[model samples]
Target: MTISPQDLLAAASHSKAWPFQEAQRLAKRLPEGKPGGVLFETGYGPSGLPHIGTFQEVLRTSLVRRAYEVLTGGVATRLVAFSDDLDGLRKVPGNVPNQAMLAEHLGKPLSRIPDPFEKYESFAAHNNAMLRDFLDRFGFDYEFVSSSDCYNSGRFDDALRAVLANFQAILDIMLPTLGEERRRTYSPIMPISPTTGAVLQVPVEVVDAAQGIIRFTDADGSVVQQSALGGMAKCQWKVDWAMRWVALGVDYEMYGKDLTDSGIQSGKIARVLGGNKPEGLIYELFLDAKGEKISKTKGNGLSIEQWLTYGSEESLGFYIFANPKSAKQLHAGVIPKAVDDYWQFRAAIPGQDVDKRLGNPVWHLLRANARHEGADAPGQGETLPVPFSLLLNLVGVLGASATREAVWSYLGNYVADADPAAHPALDALVDKALAYNRDFVAPTLAKRAPAGGEVAALRALDAALAAADPATSAEDLQTIVYEIGKQPEFGFESLRDWFKALYETLLGSEQGPRMGSFIALYGIEPTRRLIAEALARA
Candidate 1:
């Protein structure tokens, strides 16, 4: 039998160490059945760069869906990510190109703003595209529904009417629950404009579904209007959540710790709508390097784009996987160590003593990597390296490889650099490195080359190789080169000095993995030829 989301939830709930009490409570609240199973939903306001937190929500929900599907022997759950593009601008995000546009967009939907990136038609579209791209990159299969699309499709009409009708009931329930000031400020369905500090009045009577126009009356009974054109209509943020649960028939939803109180209030609204309240799971906020909660408006969040650039997909995955859904701060600096640990855990699990505390997922990933490592063509075993180590090596090699021949030459030198006496373990490490490099590093490297002295070092190395004796071993050559540096002018044991000179002249880093090992794996001839050519260009 497959592991299902329910089984996973059950396992999590029963575990004495499970940190999320809310998740346990929400799981208990779920209706009994294998039929009409949970519909997991996570909503994000599409206003700026979707951060790692945004991805975490979708990923977490998807994991739940996977768990359910596995346990049930069928797809028992659906994971939906709702883009709340129809949400009005609450504040101008700090890094946004246009600050003045925020005022015009106040009390208006985000889908209405001109895209600062100019690629997408609107601000919402740009952000939505970013998020879609992010999720797609992570191989997450999800149903994406945009608020603008849903509202324009008239999917929310019934729910909107339901909400409007029970607006009084919503008010009655909320008024007593909230303090006097907050009660007056709160509405049954919509969020007040945080920027304007005004209650957003939903237009009434202009309900032309065909034209997507909705008319509203101001407090003074003056005519006010907005259009749900392009699949969006004005809806209060809080009310919209309830309406979405009803309209989309969501069974489960997760929220950030900051929204715990609001999530509770939303549950009341869900009851008022005569629909089952979606199970709410509250996860803690992720903090930036400085330990402050990541906030888009404050430009304080680490973006998914930035994370992808600096870290591997597995690194990002481990970040979300390892973290408990509680009020805790996550540090960006911890990612590299996490990745290293994940790799170590992966390596230690196959045919080794299994540490009970390390758990199954770590074992699964290791076994997966091991399977991949085993499947490569025979005899090429010596060429491969560990994924992380390969990254470290490529950071050096790519500094010099400006062209295909240069890259090939670098690879040749890399192969030549390997020590045959080096343990079979080293070979395995190298194999994984090659795999990671081919699959991940090359694409990112192809986008942009190194700049400044790194490039110069590569060029210089190329020139020096062109002039060197073809038969000279990489080790002997390096020794001679280092000897030259031992001169008084170059100072004592100055590998840095030699490296700086090489980088300044060739455009590669001064210090890299063992040059002997690199050159052995990469042939001397290709290294010489490519380096010569690069020097000529320089």
Candidate 2:
């Protein structure tokens, strides 16, 4: 596991990935021979059901943690997947099972709200279970920390004392960010109401930092005193974030772009509380394809379950890995491109330098499965098969089948002479593509017409392909396809557009596999007949 410092430095300087750069900065920030392992944190708000955005934060932070491990010679690292379920329910969500029941519990901590779904003891417990289930399904390694547990078990008591002692300093850092009315009512600690059991946000009447207690005016006009330790009281979120950094000894954490101000305020509060702030990264939020923000409240984006249905989990990981800070679209349509990109990256891994190989998203995605836990070193992971997008197209072309063996037989015709079991990853992709095509791809199939010049080009390509041998080498067949696109009759500005026309007319989509390999595998005569039929209909 030991890596040379030079190797770590090379990763920092040569890689363009954000996680790598963040890890490099982290390594330098820590003093030489620091005693404790690095702690990476991602927080979830359990106000409603868990969603894809929640997964994105953990995945991004975990990637950075993995990169850090590589940089520091397998240095000890821990990722704390913390959930802020202790926070009060601000509003009733439109999507949960029983809206009326949730509405009645507004202002109560999520942990105290009864589960409308009847599956768990409380709403928070149900959501937390969803989080753990999905993460475990992806084989993510981490310790789950519930804010309620940290508070109720007295684990946050020491940090609570620190916040109480520096109450004014923390308030000073936060008040300017609030309007005058909020500033007047704001207190860094809110007591759990003894009567209604809601988290009372009323003004604090007195603070006894010396005794670790606070007195606050409740919403119903009673003055109540509660110990800051245990479940009696909890720090406000900004203060809580800083306290968690100190109590958990977190080294790095990330938040959404919207939390820029909160991060700044938390860092200042952490400094005042006698702890250094964890290094923070802010990622741009996901947007829907229509360019509107993807929000849990709006229910605008695809869910984790939906994403998994249309695409492999590794594809979703690649989508997140690409431009981590850029605002990317989270849609079902993006899944195919993600799958193709994963294959491309996996294909490039052989004989690559350490830095170049780590740049591949597959390298990070592989660690999601326990089987590939220690496969982090350079040139690791099994080779992938032909792009899943291609298999999906092939599935569409081959029509419905009674069994998967028929589909594998079609694939063997293209790959030529090699047993697919020799490539387990590709074999798995074939199974996935079959199911994905039947469920998602088949229902969308439609006939497409050729454009102005495409008709003649299709005609010529069809004739040439009819005469070409199916046993032709992939390289030679590929050259023939390229040459057909170059014909003046096509007037294509690029070879890509010509290929796009072929895919549209043949597969009912504008994207598919390499024409040479596809034609050779699918049988050139059948392709010629397919093209000629389309021409006749046009």
> Model 1 over residues 1-538: C-alpha lDDT tens digits?
1333454445544443222333344455542423565677888878766677777777666555443333333435667888988777777777777678666666566776778667778889989998888777666667788987887677777776676566577677666766766765555434223344243644234355445455554545456565534243445556677768877888778788888777777777888888867765667878766778776557676666655545555556566765446554555445445556555544444433222222434432221221233211232212224334434454335543433334344444434444434534443334344444445444544222334443455554555666676666757767645555455543434667555544333224333444544444445555565455445654
Clashing pairs in 2: none
Model 2: residue 59 alpha-carbon error in angstroms? 1.7
**TM-score against native, each model:** 0.60, 0.89
For model 2, residues 358-393, the per-residue Cα lDDT tens digits are: 676777766543546443455453455466776777
Mark the regions of model 2 whose C-alpha exceeds 4 Å error after superposition.
Answer: 1-16, 31-33, 367-371, 376-381, 398-406, 416-424, 427-462, 485-501
RMSD, candidate 1, Å: 10.8
State candidate 2's TM-score: 0.89
lDDT (C-alpha) at residue 534 in model 2 = 75
Each model's lDDT comes to 0.56, 0.80
Indicate the residue-level lDDT of 80 in model 2.
84
In terms of lDDT, the poorest run of 10 residues in model 1 is 367-376
